[model samples]
Target: MQPIGWVLLILAIILIIIIIKNFQIVPQSHAYVIERLGAYKTTWSTGLHLKIPFIERIAKRVSLKEQVVDFPPQPVITRDNVTMQIDTVVYFYITDPKLYAYGVENPIAAIENLTATTLRNIIGDLELDNTLTSRDVINTKIQVILDEATDAWGIKVKRVELKNILPPREIQAAMEKQMKAERERRAKILDAEGDKRSQILVSEGLKESAILKADAIKESKIREAQGEAEAIMTVQKAYADSLKMLNEASPTDKVIALKSLEAFEKAADGRATKIIIPSEIQSMATLAATLKEMVSDKNIDISPKSEQQAQTTETNS
Candidate 1:
C-alpha cells in the first residue's frame, strides 16, 4: 500500500528470481560454460552448481557424455580417377566446457565439415581397391588428424569410421566380375597342379615296378643258367666214367661172343609171344662167316663150341 513497501516487495521478488536462476542443477555427464561479460569464465559439472547471476551468464551448455555425429556423404575421386560417395561417423566428447564454448564457434559443425574434407582428401590419394580394403587404416588416420585439429576446441575425438563406401554401379559390377574370375582361375590352377603331381607319382611308381620286374627276370635267367650248367657237368662226368670202365677191361673173343648172344636173348625176351630155335643154330653159315672175319688174327678162335655143348646135353638126356 505504501510506496516504500511496494519498492521493497519488487526487490524481494527480483532477488528470489535471481537466486533461483543462479543455482543450476546439471544432470550427470553434462557441463555448462559460464561467461562473464561475454568472455571465458568458469565451467560447471553435474549436480548442484552455482554461478554469478547478474554478471555471469551461461554462454553455452555442452554435454560431457560421448556423442556420435553421422556426417553426410561426400564425393571423392580416387587416384584411378573413379568417383565414389563415402559417409562417415565420429564419436567425441566435450572434455573442457570452457574451451568447448569459447575456443570455437559451432564446434559440432566445424568437426563435421573438417571430417568430410579430411576423408575426401585421404581417400583421394588411394585407389578404389585400397579404399574398399584399407578402411581401418583410413579411419585411424582420420581420427588422429581430427583429434589433433579439434584438441583446441576441447573435443576429444574417440573414433572415426567410414560408415559406407559406394562406388559407381559399373565399378561394382566390374569388381564382382573380377573377383569371380580370380576365384575360378585359382581353382583351375590348383586342379592342374594336383593333376601334375598325381601323374608324376604314378610315373614314378610304374618306373619302380618295371625296375623290379627286370630284376626278377635277370635273377630267373641266372638261376636257369646255373641249373643247366650243373646238368651238363653231370652228363659229361657220366660219359667219362662209362668210357673209363670200357677202356679198363679186355676180354677174350669167345667171352665177348657169349656176352653178345646173352644180350640178344635178353633183348628178345619181351618181343613176341613165342620163338623157336634149332639146336646148333649158332653154326649157321651167316653167323659162322661173321665170327670167322672178326677173329682172323692168329691168337683168336672161331670154333663152334655152342654145337658141342648141345650134343653133350642131348647125350646126358
Candidate 2:
C-alpha cells in the first residue's frame, strides 16, 4: 500500500471508532442533556442516540426517577421568640433535563438552601406550640413553595416533610411536666367518680336492706294477727256448736228443772255478790231444806244409862 492510502485508512478506522463511541443508549427513568458547540441544544430521552464527535457533547445526565434529600437541622425562630432546630426531607424529580443541566450550579445544595429558607419563613409565623403540632401544615406549605420555586430548575417537588423539630431542653422539660400534671388531674377525677359511684351503690344497698327488714316485720305482725283472729273464731264456733246441740236435745220439764237447779248450785258455789233464785226452783229448794233438817235430828244417839232406864220403865208399864 502507498503511504497516503495507509494514512487515509488509519484515519477512517479512527473515525469509525469515534462514531461507535459516540453512540449513546439512554436507560429508563434517565435523561441526557446535549450541548452543541458549548450551547444548549436538546435533551435525549430513554433510547439509542447519536452525537457528533467534536460538535455535540453530553452536558449532564439527569435521573428522571423520584429522589429524596435529607437536609441538616437548621436553626429557626418561632413567632413566640422560641428558637428551635428543624430538619427536613424533600422528594423531587427532574422534569426538564435541559433546565436541570444549566439552571443551577449545584442543584442539591440549592434545594437544601431553599428548603431551609422556606422552613424558616413558615416557622417564623407559628408559635412554639403550633410549630410542634402543625407538622402537616408546615409540610404542605413548604412543599407548595418549593414546588413553585424549583419549577425553573426542572425539579418537581413531590413532597416536603419536617423530619424532626427539637426545642430547647428547658421547654421540653416544661412540656413533660405539664403533660404529667394533666394526666394526674384526669386520674384524680376518675378516682373521685369511682368513689362517688361506690358510695351510691352502698347507700342503695342499705336502703334496700332497710326496706326488706320493714317488710318482713310487717308481714310477721300481719301473720300473728291473723292467727289470733283465727283462734278466736275457732273457739266461738265450738261454743256455738255446743249451744246448738243442747237446744236440739228436746229435754222434759223435770230434766229442765234439774238442769236449772244444777246451774243455780254452780252459781251459789261462785263468789258472786248476789244470787237470784228462779221461781220454779224455789219449791225444790224448800223441800231440800226440810229433808236436810230431818236427817240432822236422826243422826243423834242416847247415852247408855238413859237408854237402860227407858227400857225398865217400859217393862213396869
Candidate 3:
C-alpha cells in the first residue's frame, strides 16, 4: 500500500481504540467526574458512561458507598494535663462527585487533617478520666465537626469512633485500687449495719420478757389480796350465823337436867358392867347428889343376884 494510505489506516485504528477506552462501566455505588476543556464539569451517576475522546475527560472517580479508614494512635492532651494515646476510625462517602473531584486538591489528606484537629479541640476540654471513659461523647463530637468541615469537599462523614484510649500504667493501677477500696468500705458498712440490727432485736426480746414477768407478778399480787379478803369474809359470816342460832334460847332448867340425865344413863348403860344403888337414895334428890352418892363408895361389892335385885328395884322406883 502507499505511505499515505497506511497513515490513514493507523489513524483510524487509534481512533477506534480511544472510543473503546472511553466506554466506562461504572459499578452500582461509584461515580465519575467528567471535565470539559480541562475545566470543572458535571459528574455521571452509576452505570455505563461515555466520554469525549480527549476534549472531555474522566478527571476523578468517587465512591458513593460508605468507606472505612483506620487512623494510627495519636497523643492528645486533656484539660487536666493528662496525655493519652488514642486510635480512631472514620466512615465517610461522597455525596457530590463534582465538588469532591474539583474542590480539593487532595480530599483524603484534607479529611484526615481536619479530623485530627477537630478531635484535639474537643478532647482538650474534657478531663483525662472522662476522655478515657466517654467514647460515645467523643465519637459524636468528632462526627459533627468532621461533617461540617468536609461538607464543602462533597464528603459526608457518617460516623467517627475512638477505637481505643490508653492511659498510663500508673493511672490504671490507681483506678483499680480506688475501686477495690470503695468496695471494701461498702462491705464494712453493711456488716456494721447488720450487727446493729441484730443487737436491737435482742434488746427488744429482753424487754418483752421483762414486761411479761412484771405482768405475772402484778396478777399474782391481785389474786393473793382477793383470796385474803374472801377468807376473812367467810370467817365473819360463820361467826355471825352461829351467834344468830345461839340467840334462840333452850327450854327450862328442869327439862335440861332431865334430858341430860337420860342421855348420860343411855351412854352409861352401854359402857358399864354393873351399877350400885346407895342406901340413902331418898336423900339424894339432885343429879349432883345422886352421882356423888353412887360413886362415893368405890370399893363396895355386890353379888350377881343382889345386883339383879337392885336393878329391879330401881326400875320399879
Candidate with maximal TM-score? 2
How badly does each model clash, as a count of residue pairs? Answer: 0, 0, 0
Q: What tens-digit string does per-residue lDDT give for candidate 2 at 177-250?
A: 99999999999999999999999999999999999999999999999999999999999999899868878987
Off by over 4 Å in 3: 1-7, 176-317
- Candidate lDDT scores, in order, read 0.79, 0.83, 0.78
**Predicted structure 2, TM vs. truth:** 0.58
Candidate rank order under TM-score: 2, 1, 3
Candidate ranking (lDDT, best to worst): 2, 1, 3
Q: Can you write out model 3's per-residue Cα lDDT over 128-173, one digit (the tens) per residue?
A: 8788778899899999989998899889999998988877789878
TM-score of 1: 0.55
Which of 1 and 2 is ahead in TM-score?
2
Q: Can you tell me which runs of candidate 1 are displaced by over 4 Å?
A: 1-3, 178-317
Candidate 3 RMSD computed on C-alpha atoms after optimal superposition onto the true structure: 16.3
Q: Please, what is the TM-score per model? A: 0.55, 0.58, 0.54
Of the two candidates 1 and 3, the one with more favorable lDDT, higher being better, is 1
Q: What is the C-alpha RMSD of each candidate to the true structure, in Å?
A: 14.0, 14.9, 16.3
